[model samples]
Target: MKIAVIDAQGAGLGQTIIKKIRKEIEKDIYIIALGTNTFATSNMVKAGANVGISGERAISSFCRTNKIDGIIGPIGVMCSGSINGEITPLISKSIFNMECTKYILPLQKHGIYIPGTRNLQIKDIIEEIVFDIKNNLVLIS
Candidate 1:
């Protein structure tokens, strides 16, 4: 299975997600790291993503042409004017319009909050996400 982990800025969240996913899921899977900048992409790559890409145009173009089975990222990825405006309208539109499941971390920024969510640590949230992916998604390997 192929999963795209999108992030911006520092990409610490994306790196953590990749590491946990690798540790938890024994099955062979391809993780693609999509970042809004070089720092983010390189960080994710160092964390063991199979491949990494950066920039708004690259992200938009890849999402348009590639077959991404799933997408995981902060809620900012889907919100235009998010991540300090790093996520463009095209990127948001492409991600939202893609025919793939999205596992979004309910991170509140820029006055956006995911209602009813507890103030869980990043590790706890990632564990839940990894568990959900393992239980809910079918992997072909």
Candidate 2:
């Protein structure tokens, strides 16, 4: 299975997700770290992603052309002008257009809200994502 963990800024969230996925997923999964900047990408790579790519064009093009089985990231990744505009419009559109299962973290920092998810903590959300991937995508793909 192949998964892409997308993040911006310092990539703390992406790093966390990669670490959890590595620890939880027993299958031989390939992880791609997509970050809006160098620092973010490097941090996720350090967190054990198989490969890391940064910047708008590279990330957007890769998402548009790659065969990623799953895409994981905060809600900001889908919104243009998110993360103080670090997530470019191309990046958002490319991710949305990708033909893959996407597990988006309901992070309100992007000013977007998902009802019923507001009460869930980050740890809970991460756990749910990891569980879903392991139980569903991993087994099927």
**lDDT of all predictions:** 0.88, 0.92
lDDT of 1 by residue, 1-141 (tens): 789999999999999999999888856678999999999999999998999999989999999999977899998898998998999999999899888889888876777877777677677888988877786655443
Lowest lDDT sum, 10 consecutive residues, model 1, at: 132-141
Candidate 2 matches the true fold with a TM-score of 0.95
Q: What alpha-carbon RMSD in Å does predicted model 1 have with respect to the real structure? A: 1.6
Ten residues in sequence with the least summed lDDT for candidate 2: 132-141
Give per-model CA RMSD: 1.6, 1.2
Scored by lDDT, the top model is: 2
lDDT of 2 by residue, 1-141 (tens): 899999999999999999999998845789999999999999999999999999999998898779978999999999998998998899999999999999999887755778898789999999999988888764776
Overall local distance difference test of candidate 2: 0.92
Clash pairs, model 1 backbone = none
Using alpha carbons, what is the TM-score of model 1? 0.92
Number of the top candidate by TM-score? 2
